[model samples]
Target: MKKIILIWFFMMFSMIFSETNSIYNTKIDMKRYPNASVVTLLDRESIIFNKDNSYIIKKHIIKRILNYKGKKASSEYKIKFDKRFEKVDIINAKTVKISKSGIKEIAVDKSKNIRIIDAPSDVGLMKYAAHKMEVIAFPAVNEGDIIDIEYTIKNNKKQKISGTVNFASREAVYNKVEIINIPKDMNFNITKFNWNTKMEYMDNIAKDRKIIKFSEKFMPQILDESNIPESLKFMPTVIFTNYNNWAEYRDELLGKFIKINKSKENLQILKEIKEKVLDKLITKDMTNMKKEEIIQDFIAKHIEIKYIDNLLDFEASSPKEILTRGYGTSLDIENLFLLLLKEEGISGEIVILGSDKLVWDDVKKGIDMNRFNYAISKVTIDNKDYFVDATNEFSKLGESVIENNIGLILDTGKPEFVNVKSIEKNITRIEKSYNIKIDLNGDALINKTIYFYGINAIGEREKYKYMTPIMKQQDYQKELGMISQNAYPISKQMDVELGSPVKISYTYKYTNFASIDGDFIYFDLPYRLDMLDLFENVRKYPFELVSDILRKNNISIEYPANYKVRIAPKSLEIKEKNMLIKRDLKIGNSNGGNKIILDTVVRYNSHIYTIEEYSKLYKILEKLNYPKNAKVLLEKE
Candidate 1:
């Protein structure tokens, strides 16, 4: 009984394999040419079965032939096959004769063996046989199956070439992958070509036999060396290849060349340039001058940059060409700056640095040489090192542009470590004011004034370009609303004037004031709105951004002299390590009636707070929102 059971199991397994292994056949028919040769593919199937009972099957088939006019030319092509599942035998059988319709048929047995039963002629059959043998190989396939087919035409010219090949079953999925390989016999000149594989899957989840890998290659025609101009000699030669591991290969190649070509030659060129610049810049008349001033003047006047393509190559023109051309990339500017410094006999070095946006100091761990692209000039003035990027149109002298400050800088000349000085202490400030009067009907005629007096002004003006006119107006309204929410203005106007570093000033008029009970006055100040509640709720988050805020206000109200102060709000003042809030209200008799003035100031300097700190700080600010009392009474005239 046990022997019978084992035999039954074996038979079941064989039947399952045979059923899946059957090929899906398709035929392409072309009867225009009888003597024309053609090659056809049968069917390819993927069988997924572990050592256990569970298994999955996927199959693909293609049957197409192209008629080619006999032309004698050497060509290079490659054939690729997808192999995603366990091993299976690819059998090659004899081709049989079919009718003149160019239609060929294939037959598959119950055991899944496929045979090409019909073809146009025996020679066509021989060609098909050769293709079948040569094309059967293991292809790199993961999720799905792919077969790349390539063939060359040697000699064949009869009636139009046309024929059909058959795949036995229709159960398989077939795709024709592109072929890109130089034939061993062809002496073709390939300038550049890149080949990459793309994997396609039916679903987000990958299956053992679902990933299909296809490769594509791009080729450009080669030009004669004689026709190439003498000015362009520095062209880079790139070699791209496909392997099981690409990152490892890239590192290996970079390692091989980086050490040999990127060290000694680069350093020598930088040192030579530096000496020449120092000689030209330092003279007997300039002996008593400060190093910073000299270096600034030299960089501003001498460095001429021209920007071109990203790749570095040989150019007939020198730094003089850069000066003649006003526009250049950051690298070109840096190169020109270095060259000028060399000519002036100053000790300057070219340092390569990555742009700040792409390089993260913590994420990259140590510095990365591969990321470095832009160059900056490092000059020693008064025995102190200063890094300068003069490529920016409005950048201050000796200051690194924002984009180059945070990334890694490598001194290509001396290999000695150089540190970039911190310049965060530079701060910009803006000041504004408004003076106005309110009449008996709560109509206030006011002159609003604004002043910008720092680098921040320039930055703000530049940032305003990104906002629409309506948005800018809204922002202005919001800022003023913070001072007096109920103070609505009629017409608003703005004027901008540029000062040395940067300063802008704006002045406008405001009207409409709110008066309560025909005597008491009140205004909603959006900026004064209690933020303690919101801050407390969000304090538990990982990080908190605290805006640096400092505000002061003075308000004066006019009234009839007969009126007198009936009530006064309690003055409040609160202080902490990083925050301060103060409010004062005063009321007195004026010639018209009673004049009331309110003054308030708030300041916050901590820009960022951790979760725990924010939670505690938020609690303290929450208590500042307690309302105060203020009132006024009338006296007999």
Candidate 2:
């Protein structure tokens, strides 16, 4: 009886708003928003919090289509809700036409045309719980017609009353509003991200109700832009939560994690793995690094992580279930790592983080689980903390694949935030050693050994993991052809190990590498000295980098003993705020012939750069790439 009363109360306040409000009837000047395909007449959401911890979130939007794009874009809309957490209802969906006499409305039949499917929301980090969805289709949607949609998600999972409401739209919005109603005494955290406007609060709207309303006028449409760090940074949004503090959020998650480790079946499997990995041999003298390496490597090679995206959607299944299924979500996979660590008598914890894009300072505005995208394992060996992520099949130990600054370490009953400075500092390094021997005809046989470390090794391993030897040879041939038009690979060998460095050595022949003039031979260094062209444009948004890169290329060329060097490539050192590109030369004799050796290194030191910084980098690149400094001329003695 009480439950019925609570539902009625939430519905009363959530859906009782008048549609005759002036904003709904206001006419928009189409000329003001020429770029928009549609104009939002009214976009509003109402959140009513009940005393029983239930919530009814109602959204009402009215969009007027200006062209065919708008008609198609807004024709079918979807609403998702999990059966375990909430229920969804399409209160009203229709097309509105204003005529000379009156306003005509054509309502869509929810029971007939709605396609209900079991789909989950990919929350960036992994796929999360909102499974069931209703895709409502509007019939006979035409340009100049207004699409009005109203729906409500009745949530019973009151403990997790947190989400974001975006004010930005794909089309222009004339007026947007969000209204929240709670009990007079209840205080919820309201954080505005990328929103510059203010909300009005009526603390005493009723005898026991408090109302908070935010309204924005003339919101521009979201456009596809380059170099944007995150769309949320440019879009206006509001993230609200009732969790009081981080401790409360951590405690709830800790309770769930503690229950995950209590399964005996999973414990048995972990013990078996321990015996196999450690062998119960007292003579082995197992070391901490070896234990971590073997444990993480076993999981990385054996267990496959399902690439379903983000945090709030996946359930942390039992250890036995995860192993039995053969595949698990990233969180569940990492959870299994923590359980195994405990069985091995090694102290470690599972670390959770949103995208490495956001730090504690940004996400600290509210406790939101949807923002997280990564889960990793952390252990201390040799007094040094190492982070391990087994999600990347070719990832090395302590080499994280993502750029993140903060991690939430889930300790027993105590969750703490840790800085991921060490992993971000882990450079994806590549070293290329090239030995070239050129005959009097300017044709050369090149022997190259490429050493990849950190994430770079993982990338190379992943790139060739599924390819045949023939395919690898073809790929290497194509890469070698970058130096000379007729260059092709001869033979190549690769030793792939996920937790260690990956080395690839191949021999290729470069034909006509040097341009021959009557008595002088001119050759340019067969190296890509132009590294700054990747960010040459420096778009309106901030340039974002996922990881730092360090590339070292060493090239040695041997010519005839009778040739004397006339001109050598000039060395360069171009340094900026967050980047360094330097080249050095060592000239000497090798094997009774004149040898010209050049070493070049390029490093991008930061993850994010403003337009100003990029401009400075562009200037440096202009000087380094032009002026033909890599040209070397040799004349026969």
Candidate number achieving the greatest lDDT relative to the actual structure: 2
lDDT of 1: 0.39
Q: For model 2, how does the per-residue alpha-carbon lDDT over 85-195 read when each residue is reduced to its tens digit?
A: 788888889877765776778899867768887764533323343467788898878888788888899988666557777776657888888888988778688877676
TM-score of each model, in listed order? 0.39, 0.85
- Cα lDDT tens digits, model 1, 338-422, are 5445444556555555423322332133222333445566766556566666553333433344322333433332233333432
RMSD of 2: 5.3
Which portions of model 1 miss their true places by more than 4 Å?
A: 1-326, 335-365, 368-391, 394-430, 451-455, 461-493, 524-541, 544-608, 616-637
RMSD of each: 21.1, 5.3
TM-score of decoy 2:
0.85
After superposing all C-alphas onto the true structure, candidate 1 shows an RMSD in angstroms of 21.1
